[model samples]
Target: MDDRRGSVLVLTNLHDVTTDIVLRVLAARRVPVVRLDPGTDLLAEASLSASYGTGGQRGTLRTPSRDLDLTRVRSVWVRRPSAYDGPPGLDEHDRRFAREQAFWGIGGVLASLPHAHYVNHLWNNRAAEYKPAQLAAAQQVGLLVPDTLITHAAQEAREFVACHGSGVVYKPLWNSPYRVAGRPHSVWVREVREQEITEAVAVCPHLFQARVDKAFDVRVTAVGPWLSGVRIDSPDLDWRRRQGLMRCEPVDVPGAIDQSVRAYLAHFRLVYGAFDFAVTHDGTWYFLECNPNGQWAWQPPDVTDAIAQALADQLEKGSAP
Candidate 1:
């Protein structure tokens, strides 16, 4: 196996259609690619050793089939890496500790890749994924944003709801898996009633925002400096909830919103972002959120191809001439 580091490492889920598309693009370019599901399959086959010394730092990532010199890696595309599924043999407590170590060990080392151009670096991605941080960055960059409040106090939530009306929506801090009826479930973003603001909210922090009275929603997937937006018109509050009921068309982004979006990306040092925007009836665009490592393969073919090419260019070119 080649020990060179000039390969694109893809961290992804078990069944990622986008990863398959991206892999095809890379293959067409004659680029070497290594794809793995870190939370499950990778732990068994992947081994990484990183060391720091007086001279410099060096590391190697190895699978039984191949070896990659960490210093030479061209790019690391960190997609949606799920949590570590602990060892099947260990007890819950021991398994938890084991998983924690693996996360900080292998995961931390990957995040510290010295020469790799991360599509959206893991640490940066994590910070930018915070909805509150996304909102703050959007507002700071002069983008119109709906009034929002994140709180754990029931009274505070009630007051905010009263202020924003029944249209105020409750957004999950993160869509983590919850066991309901012994089955996994997720809490999606939904409208909240003023009466729904009860002591139950005090159990944890909840994000509430004044609903953007909208005609449509815009999904802008930015690859490096290139931007592609899809205008989605739907009757649903969350277009994603009922995507089949929506009409998506390619649209040009206004210069002002484009500039603000560029600023937001710069603030987070992200090379790629899937930005969500709420467009009002009067054609005003309100910033929703930016998923630093969001999916883009679901976009229109032409747009997806462009994004693929742009990403390939970035990985191959790096920051050097």
Candidate 2:
């Protein structure tokens, strides 16, 4: 048996809502966890103290900063770091350093350390951010994918729209957060008609794809080696389009699809992924995209429990979680 004593460190910004659920699950398994936000007041005293302490020596864990021996940490779950808008009462110069430290200073230093099983390493995640790369990777793994085009020229977009007839959909390539009247607006899947493409292409390079007339939606949540498959059905084109009107069923994932997903995860070096799929009327499954840090709490409670259990098991085993 592999014997190692360590605590799981979750580095996430304050806005993340999943931390509570994950914490509760880890707590239930008696796994120790420390939450660190680099944006907060850096407890240099505590960190320096911990850094100087002998390895494996019992010490009081502090807030904002805790001594985590790289080798001992079983896993790390990194969500976005807290946005440092500056401390309330600090001078501008100090606050600037604080903000920089959150993402570049301590944050960068800690991430560069050579230990711990990360959910999705920042560099890997950054590399996988390009849609073209993801599509190529998905296709290489033998997953059926829809025909897509990424273009800035209006003529190219027009041609793509015409080729798909009424079966085309447009989405943002980078998913830049958009605002309308100071409120966030999400892009919804809609039928792309030729008439709608007049000047839209000139505005930006949009991602257009053949909109699959899906028979159903599938969300495959992969955490470590575990997979939780959920079938989503809705009258709308996209289940996310009408949130409250969708139905979900716990289903067994096909072996091939599961294998493809596993390969996809490995290719991206991610321990967790929320993959969206479109099952066609002909029974073929088409991969849409994989969200490295997708939301899984909304899935059935049983599914959540299963994922949480899998994560805990991985962490306890000192493997990827």
Candidate 3:
């Protein structure tokens, strides 16, 4: 089969503007694309029938717009798709059972698609999401990593903060959706003092790191062999909170940082990554966490377009097998 003739299967929710950018690029190039949300589509707006034998696995997935031949998928872009919620109406117990089936059944099929190139394979994305794993990988690749500690003990948290006399910051291991008083809440990076450590720290594992007295933050978005570095200038500790007040400009990636970025991606077998770095006054690039499936559409227009084009190029080329 000619891989180029196959369609690009996009797995993302309807409101994902990032996926929309890439889809537009694909459409402009006349690449066949089939976009669907497994969460809401499977068992509702979509249907599937797959089989396996001596000839290998084959199936047909019917989405609202198109019927995708599982064997003819050139690549899959696993974007921010919600979890399988099962069918619309069901009892709690039945819903749980149906969700599980949808996940392992249809999810497994999507993961097993032969000769399909995944931007960042779902398994790889899962492993890279671990902060511990990411930090270890960055250090192994010769990147400058700040002193860090992960603990569930109050005493340990206090000691960590005390030892880093310069300062320490608490960062959540994962950005799980949080709510306060019926309103969405975000946990931003904030300086933590030794005195602030309380017995509540023992209730859960918390991450603390020596804060880098940085000049600004750098967001490097990598797609395959392409890398786009953006210098973000903001007065706040976390620029994301006040993006409108921040200044963004395209910057050249340092040779060493570029090499380390590629090595880090190779370590996790990821074709895409959004790496964060804290650059100090002395021009040191301190390694921060890399979001394996991070958002890049929020970047400046030119950078976003470049990333979209690069991603589309990868999907169009598919994978060599």
Candidates' TM-scores?
0.93, 0.85, 0.98
Write the residue-wise lDDT of candidate 1 on 152-243 in tens digits.
Answer: 99999888888875389988878677989999875767899888788988788999999988888999988788888898887778777776
After the best TM-score superposition of candidate 2, give how far the Cα of residue 237 lies from its true spot, in angstroms: 2.0
Error of 2 at 9 (Å): 0.4
Q: What's the residue-level lDDT of 6 in candidate 3?
A: 97
Query: Whole-model lDDT for model 3 versus the true structure?
Result: 0.92
| lDDT, candidate 2, 1-321, per-residue tens | 122367777777667777777788788888888776655534433341223245543223355445655446666677665555655678999978766765564555555544466776767777777788889999999899999988878788888888875489876677678899999998876678777787757777778889887889999999887898999988988788777888888988999999999999899988888899999888889988888877787788888878877766765555533
What's model 2's TM-score? 0.85
Which pairs of residues collide in model 1? 5-72, 5-73
Say which candidate scores most in TM-score: 3
Runs off by more than 4 Å, candidate 2: 1-3, 40-71, 84-101, 319-321
- Report the error of model 1 at residue 147, Å: 0.9
Model 1 lDDT at residue 93: 96
Report the error of model 1 at residue 11, Å. 1.4
Candidates' C-alpha lDDT: 0.82, 0.75, 0.92
Task: Order the candidate numbers by TM-score, best to worst.
Answer: 3, 1, 2
